[model samples]
Target chain A: MKTINTRRTIRKYSDKEVSDELLDRLLTEAARTQTMGNLQLYSVVVTRSMEGKERLAPAHFNQPMVTGAPVVLTICADYNRTSTWCRNRKAEPGYDNFLSFVNAATDALLYTQTFCNLAEEEGLGLCYLGTTVYMPQMIIDALNLPKLVMPVATITLGWPDEQPVLTDRLPTASFVHYETYHDYTPEDINLHYAAKEALEENRRFCEINNKETLAQIFTDIRYTKKDNEAMSEGMMEALKKQGFL
Target chain B: MKTINTRRTIRKYSDKEVSDELLDRLLTEAARTQTMGNLQLYSVVVTRSMEGKERLAPAHFNQPMVTGAPVVLTICADYNRTSTWCRNRKAEPGYDNFLSFVNAATDALLYTQTFCNLAEEEGLGLCYLGTTVYMPQMIIDALNLPKLVMPVATITLGWPDEQPVLTDRLPTASFVHYETYHDYTPEDINLHYAAKEALEENRRFCEINNKETLAQIFTDIRYTKKDNEAMSEGMMEALKKQGFL
Candidate 1:
């Protein structure tokens, strides 16, 4: 509980290396996480070598943590192994559709979060690179991922070299609904975002980005509509090429 | 770590009701989980009333845990609140796309796993109902979820009435790839699944189902191709209806 409460995304890592044994133990335990029907539809690719990290860095948009962290893990939604086993046992496999991909992705995310908590509990820090899904084709090629396997997320891990401040979250009332969803009113939205918009750092961010409001920075600069649509197209194409569409 | 290692899904629940205060604290803390740019594209609907659970039970195929547990949480991948905030802040939101839905779902799943761990640590037990996606339209109508708010998974939570044995998992090597993915050969597949196929319980399961191999049970009965394909069609329609496609 303490670890979950105090955990932060660590981008900077020390020179200390994470031993193979420790990584193995934590990952082994994390695999115990619940899955749909005991069919663990996930696989993790461990990138420890410099060349491997360099290959993946471009996929993650050259994030410095990709190269700095001693270990980079690419969590993937995998049905290949299970499918193969089914075929080998004279049972036809049928997990090559959109819903199957969704289920596998959920299993992969559950395993990813479980591993993150365990790694943090062991005094290790990590950061999730959301770019994995945005440029999944690059990751799939770099990792030689086969059909029925898609990269969902990436984690850069090592001993923490710095302590980052805890990020802010909207009040629980912002997201928690009782009995049924109560749509947020305009007044309710204003009340919920007051603290966030009032943050000094956020104001500084808006000024530096030359944006009128913080949301403009996100829509106009960071996650533009044009970019999101293009990426969505690419993602659909990749999913089709991977036999999941 | 011990809590994680020993945690098991509890389906049967004691009648002791979970207090609102305790649930609030855990949900509030779990909201601190990492998200894509801290956008927190997730919302949870807390269902405590029997009528609410009954409304959701059919969507989950009338899973005993749904109506049996003291509380049922429908974890949703929501872009409505964030998009609403952006719109109210004089920013046009362009998150009505597939990539946005994927990112929101990832955030929701991360929150779900974090909450499960925290809840287990507090001596509460829970089970994840994967059927949430298989029949999402039913849940959407039942919960009155607005557009851009799609239920991703459901959790049945309460005090435990039974302590089931820990479920089995494949050996770590079966899924953990070093440097890059090493495709499993036919021999490797046999070697990895040998123990699972040899398990007495699994063998009995196959015998009862009148299947020759354990994999047949999954391919034929549990997750058949016909069902997966039909569900995929429904899910896509639901996504389109939810303004995510």
Candidate 2:
């Protein structure tokens, strides 16, 4: 509970290298994370070399952490290996569609988060790159990912360079529904988000953006519709090519 | 590391009811999990009543854990609240699409896993239901989920009544590549899964099913192509109705 409750997303990293042995130890242990029917439909590409990081940076929109961290782990939703196993054993495999993709993606994400939890516990700093899905085509090319495999997300890892304060979350009520989903009424939304909106950092962000409400900073600047749609279209096309669509 | 390393999936749970306060505390702590651009696009439905679990059980194919566990959490890929924030703050929102769905699903999964980790650390046991996506429409209606909200997965939680032994995983080398995805060769597959295939339990499973190999068990029975395609079609239709397609 202590390790999990105090965990923070780490963006900055020192120059110290993460030893291969440590990476192996954490990963081998995290491999115990529960998977779909125990198929283990996921893979990871560890990027430590200069060329690998440089090539993969643009896929994450050139996030500095890509190059700064000693390792960038590209977690892939992969089913090729399992399909190969079936074929080798004289059985036909049918995991090439959207449902199969969903299953594999689920496996990949569970594996990714478990690894992150263990890595954080080992004193490693890390950041998740959600950009991996939006520009998956770029990742596919950069990482030579074949059909039936896609990078779900990437994480940059190293020793921490700085300490950042923990971020605030909405009151538990905002997110947790009772026996059934409690749809948010306007009043419920306000009640749930009151403390977060009242935070000093949120107020500062609103002021910095010259916005009346902190949420405007999100809608008008942080996550615009234009960017989201453009990325969405690209994602659909990539999903098609990867044979998930 | 020790805790996470030895963690196993728990399907059998004692009838001890989880307190509401404990659930709230763990969830509140878990919401600090990093999200896409801090958008925190997820919500969870907590089911503790027998009626609630029974309603959701069919969606999970009535897995015994669904009815046995004291609590069932349906974690959702949510955007309604965030979009509401945008509109209330006088900003246009464009998250009713597939790209946004991916982001929110990623957020929801991370949140659920973090909560599971904390719950496990607090000496509770849990198992994730992969059936959430297969019958999402039933889950949507059962949970009264609104548009822009879809169940990503369900996890059953309770005090453990059984201590399941740890499951095995593929060798780290089979899944971990350097610089790029390392496609599996037949020899590599054999080398990686040799111990698993040679296990007495697996060999017994093959013999019981009259299968030539362990892989045949999956292809022929566990995850057949016929079921996958049927489920994928249904899922696409459901996603479209939910405004994500």
Candidate 3:
């Protein structure tokens, strides 16, 4: 309970190196997370060398954590390994489709979260890079991923250098609907996001960006529709090249 | 680590009610998981009523766990609340794209995994329903989810009624790669899956299913190519209707 309550996403890391033994233990725990048919349709690529980090960093739009953390782990939605196993056993495997992609991706994400929690429990900090899906083609080339294997998410991990403030969240009421989804009225929306919009940090951000509202900074600058569309198209292409279309 | 190691999917549940207070604690822990850009793009619909579960059961192919558990959580990738907040603040929000869907889905998944782990620590058992994505439209209608909110996953939770055997998994070396993915040779594949294939349980399953190999059971029956294609199309349609295309 104490560990759950104090969790935070740490971006900056200390110089202390994460041991291979610790990583292996954490990974073993991660593999224990629930999986579909116990197939465990995921894999991790460990980038420890400077050259490896440099190669993979651009795929994440050069996020500082890509290079700053002691380890960069790329979590992939993988069927290649399983497919090969089945083929060798005289079983024909057919996992090349969108449904399969979702299955593999779900397996990947669950394993990733379990690994993150275990890492935190072991006194290490971590950051997830969402760019893995957006620019997956680049990641595939960087990681040498083959057919039936696609990068879905990535994480950088090490000891923390800074104690960043825990970020805010919507009130539990705002998200926890009873029995069924309770569609938000305009009033409900206002009530739910009121505290977040009024935060001093958000106010500073809006003003600093010369935007009239906090969301303008997001739409106009950060995750604009134009960029989202392009990235989505790129992801589709990557999925096709990886034979999951 | 203990919590993870001993975890198993519990399909049968004891006739015990889950308290609201305990559910709240688990959710709070879930909200602490990492988010994309600090925008928590997810919500959950909690179902405790028998009628509600019955309505949701068909979407999961009438899986007994759907109605058997005391609590069912339908986790969604939601952009509605955040988009409304942006629009109300005089900022144009544009998250109607695949990249945004990926972001929201990732956020929802991490939160779900955290909640599951926390619940296990508190002595509850759970099972994830992958059928949620395959038949999302039925879930959308059943849950009354509005635009910009899509059910990405579902889980049933309660105290255990059965202690199911833990399932098997591929070796860690089969998935983990150093710096790059190590595509498996036929020999590598055989070396990796030998134990699983030699298991008496798997051999019995192959014979009982009238399949020559275990993978034949997956491809020819459980996860057939035809079913995968049909379901993938259904999911794509749901994605468009949810405004995440």
DockQ of each: 0.86, 0.78, 0.80
lDDT of each: 0.93, 0.87, 0.89
Stretches of model 1 off by over 4 angstroms after superposition: none
Identify the CAPRI category of the predicted complex in candidate 2: medium
**Candidate 1 lDDT, A1-245, residue by residue in tens:** 58888899999999998999999999999987899998899999999999999999998889899999999999999999999999999999999999999999999999999899889889999999899999899999999999999999999999999998888899999999989999989999999989999999999999998899999988898888898999999899889888898
How accurate locally is residue B187 in candidate 3, as Cα lDDT from 0 to 100? 84
In candidate 1, what are the lDDT values of residues B204-245, reduced to their tens digit?
Answer: 999999999999999999999999999999999999999999
Chain A (candidate 1) TM-score to true chain A: 0.99
Model 3 C-alpha lDDT per residue in residues B1-245, reported as the tens digit of each score = 46888889989999988999999978877898888888888999999999999999999999899999999999999998788878877888889988898899999999999888889888998999988898899999999998899998899999999998877767778778999888899888777778777889989999999988887877788888899999999999999999998
| Per-residue accuracy of model 3 over A1-245 as CA lDDT, tens digit each | 35667878888999998999998888877899988777889999999999999999888889899988899999999988878877776777788898899999999999999898888888899888888888889889988999999998899999999988878887889889999888778799778878988999999998888988888988899999899999999999988999999
How do the predictions measure up, each by TM-score? 0.99, 0.97, 0.98
Best model per DockQ = 1
State candidate 1's DockQ. 0.86
Clashing pairs in 2: none
- Ranking of candidates on TM-score, top first: 1, 3, 2
Clashes of each: 0, 0, 0
Query: Where in model 2 is the C-alpha error above 4 Å?
Result: none
